[model samples]
Target chain A: MMIEESFVNGNSLIHRLNPVLKIGFAIIYSFVVAVSSKFPSLFAALFIALFLVILARLNPRKAAVRLAAVNGIIILFWFFLPFTFQGEALFHIGPFAVTRPGVIFAAGITLKANAILIAFIALVATMRVTTLGHALNSMLIPEKLVQFFLLTYRYLFVIQTEYQKLTRAVKVRGFRPGTNLHTYRTYAYLAGMLFVRASVRGERVYQAMLCRGFKGKFYSLHEYSISKADITCAVFMTAAIVILVVLEWTKII
Target chain B: MDKDNLIINLTDISFSYPEGAPLLNNLSMQFYKGDRVGLIGPNGGGKTTLFHIIMGLLKPYSGKIEIFGKPVREEKDFRSVRQRIGLLFQDSDDQLFSPTVLEDVAFGPLNLGKSVDEAKVIARKNLDSLGLSGFEDRITYKLSGGEKRMVSLATVLAMEPEILLLDEPSAGLDENTRASLIKVLTGLDLSYILISHEMEFLDSTTTSVYIMKDGKVFMNGDRQIHRHYHIHPHSALPHRHESGFGKKYTDFLA
Candidate 1:
């Protein structure tokens, strides 16, 4: 029940775009943004990512929450970078000089990370993870790797359920948590039991697959077709990536 | 019964885990076409292990196994057996690996070399038969326990297997769901070896019962073998029954 694919349920243009194209473009766009050091290019990248997010028609509050989570981690960089990195000393913080370049460096990282993550959220996260696996397969990812990814995603819920059951069993037996060797040992045993059960379940799952005539090959039930909208979006996104790269290397911001 | 009608034949099958106690010792069992057999036993009684051996999921260390009168040996031999006979695992979580119900049901069909569209059609038809018609796109793991079990059955039935090996198909089902399950099993034309502990359910779904214990078929008789097959009313007192397995299987109903 906790498997929340928050952005997947939508009829937005970005959501309708071909997942293979979305994944491919997200990778290319992220690469361009990552190497772009100039503020103008980074800001342009951020603008494009935000534009895609807007095109996705995601709930504004949810989008804001996702951005907040990204920035929360970036805030840790803000704490250290301004005072640590060797650069032009701007001011003193308790005898440690805060460098202007360090602040700028951190700012650039914040922009780059947000730009890439937002684009990924808008393009890639809008599709179900199962769809992503099939898309990756179509995009020439190794079949074994795709199967591994999909199977892992599928069993995560089962493993979580097993974990909850073990926790509940211990809790009902009056097991209380505290900083003690007994607690540590009990937790270790719980974790160990989870792994053992998971492994056993894995074996049974494989056997079930065998029962169903699962040879080495995996067949996807979904067949994705490129619509006119998908083609138009693909062209536009390709153009955007080209423009971002051009802007990074050229003076024409 | 003629040997030609034997659906599954296991003779002197002995299986044991590595460095563990014997799980199945000299167990022999037979299934004829059109036979609805219910296998029942206590925990660790090798009921599941025997099912595994029948499905070729586990190979007996020493035994002779045959399926539909064909001698099944080598790893390759089980492929055709799997194609002809579907095994529904005890755990729906294990049986359903696909993310969606449709995909999971379609998995077996697709693997059996059906075209994607053909497999989808079969999957849909099977789901419809199980009254899960509108659940094509439902996430597999998000389904309620009963719904998951039904979908798991759909997955197995999608293969159009000649025989079904259901391991505890009614384990976690509530009364209403279990009743519906019994109805479904009783209505199916295909033969199946249903493994369940609920005597009433087995009595309702199967024509015969085989009690497995000490790694062998301890008792085999008609469905009326156990007098406890009747559902005791809630107001009834606790009682014991002679299962003819030389054991007093007690029912603490009050």
Candidate 2:
């Protein structure tokens, strides 16, 4: 299955926080994980991220799949770093010697990546896209950028649907992927036609928007007010992140 | 507010594209409350363009449009009244632009400044009225053609407008769906102007009919309707049949 922004529903504290504050918490969590190199602090951060994941009620198997895919790519850099770094040698692999500093660096990078991903999946992915856009706009994000995000999310399904229809038509004609010129030309033509039709559809959608009293700014019937509970969650999460980073810096950990 | 008892009155409306000849040439008509008017014409005969002109999507060079006894002269003039008069586009894709079915239906009420909860209530009610339930979270791209058309109509009806302007509503519907659509439209209490090429659908829905050509109204109160529809350009006769005012319309045809 394709990895999408699949939001899970739960009544955990993480789910009730304001989306803007959740974004801030994710940023702070990622920063603390990135700057810390101590194994104990990184391990603590990883465990906290996992606990939040469980608290948010996200499926562990689904979360593991994404983490595995990310780690699979990062592991490629480890092979070269261990051989290229000039440090105290630890192990030998045929002609290249693995170094201690390279091993520690790779371990740190892996932990940081996992911690950040877990934090994002727990804190940010729990909200709906429309509410997320509204939260960002309320946080003084430029209207244009907010609209850009909204339109992109809204029309992505439309674009995917159009492409699927085109692909189906081509398949019905017995076309298949190959390295031949005929297949490549047909694919190129299909893409061009889809773009042209999409452009025309875009204009008609705009006219429909105008007919329905659409101004430049998007207006929704629901207005979100930051609740007291949401404020408490945000403040608590921010403080936790700060204390974790300070303890790591002081080596008290 | 409607002292004239006229829901819509357009006097000598004329409009054209910059590169083309007159699309609407001296068009004039009047519609009253409780009037289900059928507007029929050939391809590119200014039917849809007339709807745009009335909705203030397109501005006419020299013409006057009155909606509910108030003159509409500019694009902004239509904002307040636009929500009161729903315009159903020719394409359901254009109308149901929201990602989810519920959101699409809720758009009109939301735009009219209804609370989100109130808009959802109205949307659910309209969808239920159309026999569509448990479809709130369905994405737009996944719906069938008939379902899309029904959802588009649901969005329009959710607004609870005083008048409806429908364009080619029966174009892509199947037999059963079209029948259901006719039944739904027949049961409506509000006035509407239906533009379609399907004469049977129009006859089933409209109380009176207008045949347009060369950007002008052909159906009139006189018998000289043949001058436009046959001999000249789109001159018309209103229901020139035995069921229509007990007159054999063949005599009016040139």
Candidate 3:
């Protein structure tokens, strides 16, 4: 539901593009922002990405909640990077000095990451995985690869369900979380048991597929036909990125 | 009643697991086109195994099985027969694999080589006919058990098979969903074989019944079997009954 909520508000020109085209444009945009070393360029790109995110019509508060949960580890890394990397001392503390370059480098990495994250969230949060797969196939991606992507997305949920069931079963057996090494070992063993159970369930799923005439190909009703509007939107987004990049190169404000 | 148009025929069919535990032994029966037969038995009576064998999903150790008047011996024959016979599995979770309801319902038609648009039309028609409109975009995992079962049946219906094999179609449904399912099942024109423990549903929906005992056909008849078994409205199990058919069937099992 959070994912669904994140897709509710966008009416921007970029949001109107085909999902596949948006994904491609996002990939290109993220790559360009990632390799650039100029602070002004990165800052401009981040601003544009945030603007596009707003255009997507997504609820900023809901998006923030979902992203906060998923990106906790990334935020932790960002927090530690400035302290760990030593550079020219901007100021000295009891044990650590914050260097100017270190700060800039960290800022650059953070900006690049945020840009990539925004693009992905905009594309995936709005489109269902089935729609995304069909759009990719319509763009002439290999059917086998598309099938793999679809299956992986489906099984990810299946695995999560299995894990929940295992945890419940363990709890019913009176297993409680604790701080000792033995408890840690028990958790590891449960994780191993979860993998085994998932594999067995996977085999049963495969058998079910075979029964239903799954001959190494996934079949779905979702279809994507690229229209003139799709092409126009893709071209417009590309043109906007080119103009932005060129203006930056020309040192225009 | 014509014998030549018999859709399914089993003779001396015996099946055992790979470890040599027998599941079905010398079971023989014939199903005519348009027959709505209900299979009933206690647990471990090989009801599901018999259904699997009839669908050609599982092979019997010995005996001859013919579907649509053709013997099933190889994978190609099984595939052809399977396409004509739709099997609605017991677990909706096992049957409905796709992420969305529309995709899961369209899977059978698409596999049978229908184009995307054609499959969509078929899937939509089936879903709508089952009164599951507005569910096309819903995720499969999020659906309730009864809804999942209805969607699973819709998937098979999209294939337009002549024969339908349902395993416990009303196992865990509430009264409302079960009543709706009964209405749908009664309206279907295809020949159907239902495996269920719902005695009331079986009595109301099926014209004939086959009870399995010890992996063999014990009793096959019209509503008379239900009467003789004393499965009446007020009666429970272990009722007194004549022993001719029951004794013979038990002897066949021994």
Candidate 4:
């Protein structure tokens, strides 16, 4: 279901583009935005990303909720950084002081974090993980690395489901966590059992792979070539980033 | 049975867990080309263990298995033999680890060194034949149980295996899905051995039946034997006329 919800949208142009192109465009855009120290350039890049999100027609409110959650964590780091560092104080509080340079540094961090997060969420949330793996593999990423990513993504839910089942099984067996040695031992035993189950399942999965004639490689068929639209999109985005960099260097945008 | 065309030969096969619990004991069987065999038994009867043995995924503590007249002892022998046979696990989630339905279906063929385009063609044909054409892009985990089973079958079928081994092909399936599966099984020309407790489905789809009890073959017969035992070909197990396939078969043996 993760794959279906991630890809297979009904009649969307963005869905039709080769996954490799989308990933390449996203990486290039994010790198350019992250490398730019000028606020204006970063802001411009953010606007273009926002425009793409709108064009993709994803739920704005959902996107906003996810963005808030990610940015909230970064903001925690931002809030604590100034307090932990020694700098010329703009203002003094009971135990902490705000400084001008700290604020600028925090602003830079916030910009970089938000830009990367937005770009990633825009591309990843819209594209299926499998498609991303295929794209990466076609781009000549190592087979082992691609397989690792694929297996990790595939089994993440399996492990979580197993954990849920274990918890349910324990609860059914009247397991209670008391402040006692027995309870701690029970918990330790359960954890050990989970590891053993996962490892055994992992071995079975490997055997299943071998039975299917897997010979140390994973293969996918993605024949969609980079079309004129893809090239145009990549080139146009690259040109915009260049303009932003030049404008920022000249202090004129 | 054509002795000359025996595709799978198991002799005195016995297996036990590392902890000394018995699973399969002195089991022997033979399957011929183009045979439609159903393996049936109660729960914990080692039906799956026997399938794994034939697929060479598991080793027996004793006895030998010959696939296409070649003794299977090592993984290297299994590598060549497994290519000739396809095994569909009971759990589609276990069988399908790929991201997309299409990729999972194409996995077997691609691994057998088929070109990407050729593999895609075969995968697409199998998916389409299963009435799952547009579902190629769908994710494997998100599919319904029936759909997942279909895709699992497609994956194996795409490999063009001569022998198909299915473990509980009808378990967890709805009536309509079961009927569709029966249709698929009946239509398939390749030799297949299906392990299931669904007597009706088995009786309807299989040319011969082998029941496993305590890890060994308990009964072997044809449709006439099933009919004489009053096993309905359309009803689930434990029919009112009889205690059940499991109970009746066990009682007969006792």
Candidate 5:
């Protein structure tokens, strides 16, 4: 599965932190990482994020795989950003110029992306997505957004399977993609069919939910309580945020 | 409970879709205590629609529905009624909506305001009863059709409903799984209204048979009836009586 439900169940400290607190930390940490231009502070933020990945007991290979896709985007920035900007020319191909400022901007974006990606892979990947909706609701995020997340999470896999089945059916009929109007029209029809099916499925699912006594409000079966562990984790996260902010502002690495 | 007491009484029930043809026309029926009624019909015969009406998912245009002597009208009224009466959808995919089998089974109890731990216990008990003890953690979509059907049943049974409306429980099962389902369903003590096209499966599980045809229902007098006595599945639930209606309806065969 290219898109994975990647909650690595574990008993590590990062895994046990309150989801609300972890989300808050990720947001603030990403913001700090984004604002920093200094290499030392950016590297320090990356190290902290990596440390959390270790604390969460995530498999290194799996984390690397997740990062690999993001790193591809980062590599694209290097290709274009370093050669496009007009600045101090650091080097040259026969006709093109590689500017120092362009290289610096590209490197900074790469650092910010890596730091934020690692932080999210550690903090968010430890949560089962259904409960993440509950946590988002408890954080006083808009009810509609939470509901949207929940409904999307519930049906995305079903829709993916639907699309896969359609593709297989097309393949079985010897429909190969070429630079032709037939292939494009076929794809358009497939998309239309999927949309129609999804709409019908949505109505049926809504009716089923009503039959089960859904009263326009979703109640999470898990009650939210602030335990001592959660409290301690909150303190730890606050300390981590302070350290990150200090590094960003002070440039002390 | 009195043996002859009517559990569900519908009088002159008439229903139709908006701008569509009428499905139920002046259909009146009475389900007595312990009536294991089987509803058999062809497609578009309104069997599933009737099930929805009983579950309060659809409203009849003109009728009075009394369940345990209480009238049902709005959504709130049905909320209380649904707790005591479970409906198994024809599509197991629709019924088992939760991501995992365990979560789906526990959904009803959790909705009833039970704590997670208590709901887990009820879910496990139901799963164990259905011979699905270790299947709890399996992904809902990854399950086989038979396993999905069993898990759906477990979800309903977890609610400890007094009455069950099962729609086409054996529609897509193989012989072995269908027989296993038959055994589990037949072993249950509570009354259920089972809708199926399979006459042999219905004959094996249901005490009485009704045919839905021409926008009405009629009791089948041709099939011989067999008496079945069952012990209460749970002590906390009330005992079920062998419906007196079933006996009188069977007399039509004689």
Candidate 6:
């Protein structure tokens, strides 16, 4: 199964932004929005995030699809939060009272969550994962952790391919999955075999690395330099985040 | 060949897996500077294991490995040996770990202490030599089987090693790709020990053939292993004896 990195490829300005700065912007923007409780700042954050999505040229329908997955868990909050929190009753749903504070709290959470997610999708997700690894490494993340991240990203596809091969072999031999002990055991065996193959492949990969003189350090061919666009992006993101903070703290909507 | 021309010498090599039977038993082999050798063996005959030992990926229980006329024992000793000797793995997936083709090809050159631009230049040159001029930005995992094999070769070639050890370079390749592989292999100026089962491929590419079986290598000389045949009336498909041994081999309906 191919990984669908739909937002990574584009010719938009956001796509051209430096990945290191983009990661930094995403983290700060998300953190700021996460701590704000007022509605004006949250709505502003949502608007900024939407602006970023527009700048990224991402398809609106696709963005909504991604947002829907995140909101699936948030919808559970809507179910219980409106009826349980202590506040002025907004309305009566049969025997339960819907509190005003509960409704407001849930709405604030929804806005904050989506604003952060959308901005992150626009900023961090626009670059390839390998580039992200380099960016993270340049940000002073541990070399081992960056290496682990990059290697995991590279091998996830291989492991998935291995999985499909095993699934095909089992399917060709009249093996049908069902709620039975035989099916469970077959799946268990399949998992076991996949692990065995993966471990063996891992050994061979390490050997191949050593053959090429891999001495505990991975060098990247990518050279990242700050451009005019990166500087503009950094300035814009900082200003937007500062405005959000001021609107929340100083109540200057 | 003179002792001065020896590229790799493995003397008294004996290796076996833990809790398993022996594989290579006192196997002695010598590779010279200007030799294209083909190593053929049955499955589980320790062909891949031998390649690993020569590159110091695996340690032999009892052996003396001499590369470039110098004895190599410890891991540090093998580091220099690995730089001069490249090994193409049996599976291209196992060989390529980078996200893109260019990065993967440049990996060996970069490891060899080349600058980024230098490594990229070498990578592009090798890729162009292999007729893969525009595959630099292509995702490694998304490549076709034949393309992946060629790219894997490009990765090995980018290092500019003195010798290459290719493990089943043509396995699972189509006719056109296999033909291209044969052309590339024959065009190389450096020496290589090609491990393959295809007699036609081995016949066209190697100057000599060695049969490895039962933990020992027997010299097969520069003989014509590729033969033409037709489907027998008694059989359903045209097939030749891959091993070219045993009593049933005479049933090819010549």
Please provide TM-scores, in order, for all candidate models, with all chains considered together.
0.93, 0.79, 0.85, 0.86, 0.83, 0.94
Backbone N/Cα/C clashes per model: 0, 5, 3, 2, 0, 0
- Mark the 10 consecutive residues where model 1 chain B has the least summed lDDT: B245-254
- Candidate 1, residue B151: the lDDT equals 95
Model 6 per-residue lDDT tens digits across residues B147-234 = 9999999999888888999999989999999999999999999899999877778888997877777787766463446656544466
lDDT of 1 by residue, B1-254 (tens): 78778889889999998998889999898899999988877788888888888888888999899898888987799999998898888889999899889999999989989999999999999998988899999988899999999999999999899999999999999988898788888899899998887777877888887778778874346335444335556767766655443353322110
Q: Considering every candidate listed, which one attains the maximal lDDT? A: 6
| lDDT head-to-head 4 vs 6, winner | 6
lDDT preference between candidates 2 and 4, better one: 2
| Ordering by TM-score | 6, 1, 4, 3, 5, 2
Residue by residue across B1-254, what tens digits does model 5's lDDT show? 36347788888899999998999999988787788989866688899999889888889999899888888888788888888888888888777777678888887888787888998999999999999999977878778889989998998888898899999999989999999999998899889999976657887989888777767877644654454655546778665545633333433423
Interface RMSD of each: 0.7, 2.3, 2.1, 1.2, 2.1, 0.9
- Residue B240 lDDT in candidate 1: 69
**For model 1, what is the error of residue B36's alpha carbon versus the real structure, in angstroms, after optimal superposition?**
1.0
Off by over 4 Å in 5: A6-13, A16-21, A142-144, A170-174, A177-182, A223-236, A251-253, B1-4, B115-118, B134-138, B223-254
- For candidate 3, the clash count comes to 3
Which candidate gets the maximum DockQ versus the true structure? Answer: 1
Fnat for every candidate: 0.93, 0.48, 0.35, 0.69, 0.30, 0.85
Better of 2 and 3 by DockQ: 3
Per-model DockQ: 0.88, 0.34, 0.41, 0.67, 0.28, 0.83
Give the alpha carbon lDDT tens digit for every residue of A22-131 in model 6.
89989888889999999989999999999999999998898899899999999999999999899899999899999999999999999999999999889887888888
Which docking category, incorrect, acceptable, medium or high, applies to candidate 6?
A: high
Query: DockQ-based ranking, best first?
Result: 1, 6, 4, 3, 2, 5
Question: How does model 4 score on DockQ?
Answer: 0.67
